[model samples]
Target: MADTLLTAELDETHTAPTFAELGVREEIVRALGEIGIERTFAIQELTLPLALAGEDLIGQARTGMGKTFGFGVPLLHRIATADTGTTPLDGTPRALIIVPTRELCIQVTQDLDNASKYLKNHQGQLRVLSIYGGRPYESQIAALRSGVDVVVGTPGRLMDLADQGHLILGKVGVLVLDEADEMLDLGFLPDIERILGMVPTQRQTMLFSATMPGPIITLARTFLSRPTHIRAEEPHDSAIHDRTEQFVYRAHALDKSELVARILQADTRGATMIFTRTKRTAQKVADDLAERGFSVGAVHGDLGQIAREKALTKFRKGGIDVLVATDVAARGIDIDDVTHVINYQCPEDEKTYVHRIGRTGRAGRAGVAITLIDWDELNRWAGIDKALGLGIAEPVETYSRSPHLYAELGIPEGVTGTVRKAKVERDEDAVVVERPARAPRKRNRRRTRAGEALDQTEINSTDGGAVATSSDSAAPVDNAGTDDADENGDKPARRRRRRRKPAGEGDAAADNSAAVNGAADDNAEVRVTADNGGHDAETADQPARRRRRRRKPAGENGAENGNGVAAEAAATTTAATASV
Candidate 1:
């Protein structure tokens, strides 16, 4: 029952003493007063009467505008005031509230719990428990086993607990869809439908969301039976609050931390929240702020639930003046006096921009919202501006330490880093490799060993000289140029040389060397010497008698010579015949 600085007074134009005056039981009024909530927001004023009378209700209001109580109060009131004689035979819940976020579950549950204080013995007999991921199941299971009159949870968790036999909804008399638009945006409509099917057909359903977008409207058409529609538009759609002034600044990424420090030096109203796109950015921003000696906390998905909750609690309790968070953490954060919301980086879309600014200027409380847009984010802002109908396509150029920005936000002028000192040694020692070090220079070191010599081969094998006529077949009619042309063109590129076959047992060199030393006869020596790369005089000098012997008895005497030479000769002759 702590006093809520965040809650706004009831909208007097609609009605005074609304919920209680609208034929709601005195018990419900006393329950709300126990929680120090004596007034109703516009959403609640419009929807309470119909919903309390068991009529279906649809409430439309932007986020952070007290839609939780719009449906939560009536639903809980119905559960508490229901007849005890009609106990649900199946042990199913009498009321169900489905929200998009786990944080919203806690939020809606708090409101429901506050409303349940007047029922019976005040043991919180409403059996209210929040079911969501990132927590163990045993507590929720035990709560359901013991019996809960109402369940507030996300779609997935609700369906999961229901299917596991931990939660029964057949007797559910009231179903509330909080943030129905968000559920559709997250593609959870099918899951919501399945949960709806589990509830009794004869039920009073309430759908409350910031928008009655097409999907949500269609959902109401199918699920709700003649529900009355209510919409509460924000007082100022695109303008800064009366207490809030807008400061658009363009700053270099490197100078942003310094600028934030300067802003902190100015008079800060209450707790401040900075929004960053990424978890790492959130942590970095928080660290930067904390190093400046500011009490800061960071909440994002990367942190464990306990740490996130602790940070949120510290922020709520005023232990921390600044909170850095990712977009996900900022959702369903129902803090009212979050004096300011700073967008460290421009959000990706208009919807995100709306939600981020919605954190402040909540529940009729005036608050400030500032956005720091880099040069590259200009195009992104263009799209967002068009979507939100903001004609200012360009943001004023700003530096982290702009005097105008300081004046606008009521920050002190000419104040440098007062809270956190910049780490001089750390910045000097920081190793920031802009790009990967140029891959090690690979030197092509050429070396020739003493024994391993390089081949002194000519690039072009042909001499460009006239073809020469030799004793055999006109010296093979040199066709080197023709070979080069076939492979490439007329370009004088180096042609790959054909390697000489190694000397084998049947090589001509072996025969020539053997014959020269008188190991073979004159005919074999003359025939071997008549091959390539040797003196023509040696072939001619062979006796005419050797020539006649070389031609005589080509088959018979060659075979008789033995030594496998005749076998080699026969194989060569057969190859030549096959070619022919």
Candidate 2:
């Protein structure tokens, strides 16, 4: 719990004094005056006196309330004062400012740099360096080796450099944790504790946040020593600025883009910011606005660090009139001229809604916030509305062409969704031609027989026939003769073939033939007479085979000689000789 609470009522009569009147250093006051930031915001005015006295405090305020400079100005002032015994003017980092995101780190670094521009030490000028991830580590290491007066960095990168012994936190006289609630939301509590342990406990510790959760308060109770809690507004009911006019409407999901396009054309509009729940939705809304001829840019988690920085830079410089972004990626984006904020998609809770709409209506300027809630998002929106005490529980059903919408937003009559002329490359009245279907390919097969290729004329077939033949074919049947004339003018003759029988009875016939024909044998290159009447001498040189038959087993012939087998063999041999 905070030991002391200071409620600074911020209302229409904001008669705050300038930084010079608050006893700020001449250099810082002059530097701020050059940037046209002379007057102190509520948070700054309340926090400056306590913070400059080297007292620990917690700053609780709405987003875009100039909280960065609240702790930043005091931090620079203490580090720049050479007479301070604890914080001597040296290159060693006398002050450390920790933020949650890289964008916030850069923003805080710029703010402190501007305030400390003319303040100096023996090393020449008061140096402020930004150390965040997504940039090369070598440069940051080199910068640390060279020494810096004040350091602004995120938790992860700060811990990395500290662990590597490249950063010196022992000499730090002041430690500030900016956006402490966002760090808790991002699960950086452990790293934050580690950083708190590293810095000197005797130094000044200041914690700032837009909202304080249970864990954040617990962290403060554990680390901060009797800190003072300062709230710019009264309580939960005053979360949003009084100058910001909020409108909620129940709209169809499909008509959201169309409705937003019309809202961009509303009168007295300047740069606008459209908030979405997802990176994809942010990109979609940005693209939709771009196609409608609106100068738009986008920043989300999906984009690289450089791209996000570039979009924010363009938005600040007036290069883009509209910016679409998701909740997490849009933190620390401060632009003074933002006039309108559209909720392309309903935020998750009251904090997100406040943060989104807080981008506009900054620096005590009047602004407008319009929310289009789909039917499914009504319950979620109701919870936010109830939490923030925004009594518009049942938003009116509206569309792109609703008369009330036009009147409420101050849209001119006869205005359409698109502002740019669409280009039509193809003629609308051109004839529609149909292309023909593709044809199938043909197949050609090459036929081969006996290691020789056969031409189409050499192969002739009859459908469902027992035999097929051609006049010039080398293929011939064993039992059939061809009537076609040959090149030598000879007629083909029929040749007969017989199969050989088993070995038992065929051995006798084979022996008898071998004995009778002498050297003439099976498949021998010997001349053979044709069984037909025709005699073709050229065919006689080819080999021919003579078939044989098998011999049967003799009955009881096994008892040869001593057992009647010899007598049966003798009788058979005599019968064969007589038959031959």
Candidate 3:
């Protein structure tokens, strides 16, 4: 039966056949009708019958073709038709759909959920859950514990849950692997094999891929049991190639951003996608375009799952006009209205190039795919061109300011890289805002000490400066000027100054002579001489001026001064000298 079905010629009629004619369950047909999908694609028409009959099959189709529903509709129908009444609703999943990416997983889950809406009325209520990384495991665990009829997820997270006993695959009635080629590219064949080993041997399995590589064939032989191969050959006049205009240009890396900015301003431009080989390049290009006044968003691996989803949602809703992304975003995104795809850098291979350009020229809409190849990447681009049979071996030389670029892309004359600000009122609730540049502030100059011309110079002894010495007479002047004086109006309070020296000295005679001479030279006597005018009077008495000496230590060889005044003056001079 499988060989006969594989050999059967697929119908390639102009009018598509209805889902009911293909033996899809009534409930699924009604659900698909509700979503406005009345007719089935070639892939769907070929695979639906084999899948609905519980036959193992392989589906081959391109990126934009209706591959999801080809397997999705059958998988949902099988679960709904099963008699799960006797089985406990212990959260064991009955069907599994493993995809390559989180985005694709969510996409497939949504599609399956929509198709299974009417399952409650036909067969008991069927629960569908999407489990992937970047989401909390508790919710998925809780959903599994309650009950789930179908589960769509990535390989790593599915294996993790299965290993932890949260996901029970023993009862899985049907298993589907979507994008098997992508999984192989991502090195998930081992994981896929492990997961296949966990499921019951007597179960229906379906595999779908855009391209059938050798590894995928080996994988199918190992797991699938006499699977029927179904290939949906695109029509000769496929709308994808007919609607999309392709251009290859050898551009300088330094001017690629400017060229892209101008191309974005083309009259025919709509929602555009820019692809780069690296996440950093994608983010840089997005930021550069945003700074140039284009409303742009970036999607890449560096962003969190929520942020990436938010950007994609905004792009779909027309909030952002341009989306810059890496090749990771090339596989799962399915936006229909994208009018332009700009390859900011050359893609690594032909398959990647096809996927990147496929973002545009979708759904029979006319689109443009522009590839900017750098000087060093010419060989890589040539390889892709030869592999895909693109006849253009030598791309045209172009620059950001080239006249041919403006003419070919339909850019207005004199248009530069910058976008002019719109005169219309801005949306107050807009999520992205263009802030005005801040003004520079003035700074004050510091004043120098020379400009102020201060009178006093701070003398520091540690820096080896001379210490100024003043006579003892200066003390009398300070006392006379003191604000706090004794009540008797005589003298203010004074502190005596004492000078001490170390015990060792040389030449005692010379020291004694120097001390006496220093004392007599500095001292001044106060005399008392008075006379009466007329009548005789006793001579006025004057207090005698006496000098007191300080006693010296027993081991000292220095001279002692007889006059206390001379000694204080000599000690002051000596102390000043020692300090200097």
User: Cα-based RMSD of the predictions, in order?
Assistant: 16.2, 15.2, 14.9
Q: For model 1, what is the C-alpha lDDT against the true structure?
A: 0.68
Q: After superposing candidate 2 on the true structure, give the runs of residues whose Cα lies further than 4 Å from its correct spot.
A: 11-14, 83-87, 421-580
Q: After superposition, how far is residue 494 of candidate 3 from its true place, in Å?
A: 31
- List, residue by residue over 1-580, the lDDT tens digit for candidate 2: 5569998876657688998888789999999988999998889999999998888899999898999889988787777774233757667888888888888887788788888889887788888999998889999999998879889999999999999999999888888888888898889999999999998878888999999999989998998888999998776447888889999999999999889999999998999999998889888888888998999999888898889889989988999889998886557777888999998888888988888899889997999999999999999999998898889999999999999998998999999999974576898899989999978965544456897876433332111011223455534333222233344423332123334333345544444443333222221222222222122223332322332433325543343433233544545543443343
Q: Residue pairs in steric clash, candidate 3?
A: none
Q: For model 2, give the 10-residue run with minimal summed lDDT.
A: 459-468
lDDT of 1 by residue, 228-335 (tens): 776654434542233454555777888888887777666865778899999999999998877778889998888987788789889888888789998876567888
Best by lDDT: 2
TM-score of 2: 0.71
lDDT for each of the candidates? 0.68, 0.78, 0.75
Instruction: Please count the clashing residue pairs in each candidate, in the order shown.
Output: 5, 11, 0
Clashes, model 3: 0
Worst 10 contiguous positions by lDDT, candidate 3:
526-535
Best by TM-score: 2
Instruction: Name the Cα RMSD for model 2.
Output: 15.2
Q: Model 3: how far is 256 from its true place, Å? A: 0.7
lDDT of 3 at 89: 40
